[model samples]
Target: MKRLLEFLGFLAVLQGVMGLVHEFADWNVGVVGRIGFLDGYEVYASVALLALGGALFAVAESRRSA
Candidate 1:
């Protein structure tokens, strides 16, 4: 379960990053709506993913040391 969470976290982070880029990037030209709601969602997902990834990384590190 922990490993699975870690994997998910990584995916979330990726999604978030993509969202942020899309939201912030000046690629709003010639596009309808001017802003993608998905990008906003990505930002939220990224934060969650980062947190989970951090926890997983810590656990793995501790196990390796042990």
Candidate 2:
């Protein structure tokens, strides 16, 4: 579970970064609309993803430290 959270957190961070870039440039390498089915809410969705990812990462860290 910890590993899964870590991986998901990492992926979400990466996707959020991509979404931010795509939001500005419209690059769209096929991941922009997929995250939370973001659609036109890319900016907000990306921010939310980043927040979720951060929380997940924190959980993973606690799990690891324990």
Candidate 3:
């Protein structure tokens, strides 16, 4: 379970970073247009993913510590 959570967390963080780069770096994540609103998608996604990753990591760490 810990390993799975860690893996999922890492994946989420990686995806979030990709989305952020796509949104802010003038890169297209898909066929989508590049605009502020579009960029916000990346921002929001990154934040959510980072949060999830952090949560998972914390949970795993706490479990191990216990």
Question: Highest lDDT, which number?
Answer: 2
Model 1, C-alpha of 9: deviation from truth (Å)? 0.3
Give a tens-digit lDDT track for model 1, residues 26-62.
4432222234564445545545555666766566555
Candidate 3 clashes between residue pairs 3 or more apart in a chain or in different chains: none
- Give per-residue CA lDDT, model 3, range 2-35, as digits (tens): 7887888887777667667776796766322344
Q: Which residues of candidate 1, in runs, are more than 4 Å off?
A: 26-66
Indicate the TM-score of model 2.
Answer: 0.78
Clashes of each: 0, 0, 0
Q: Is candidate 1 or candidate 2 better by TM-score?
A: 2
Off by over 4 Å in 3: 29-40
Give the number of colliding residue pairs in candidate 3.
Answer: 0
Note the residue pairs that clash in candidate 2.
Answer: none
Of the candidates numbered 1 and 2, which has the greater lDDT value? Answer: 2
lDDT score for residue 8 of model 1: 60
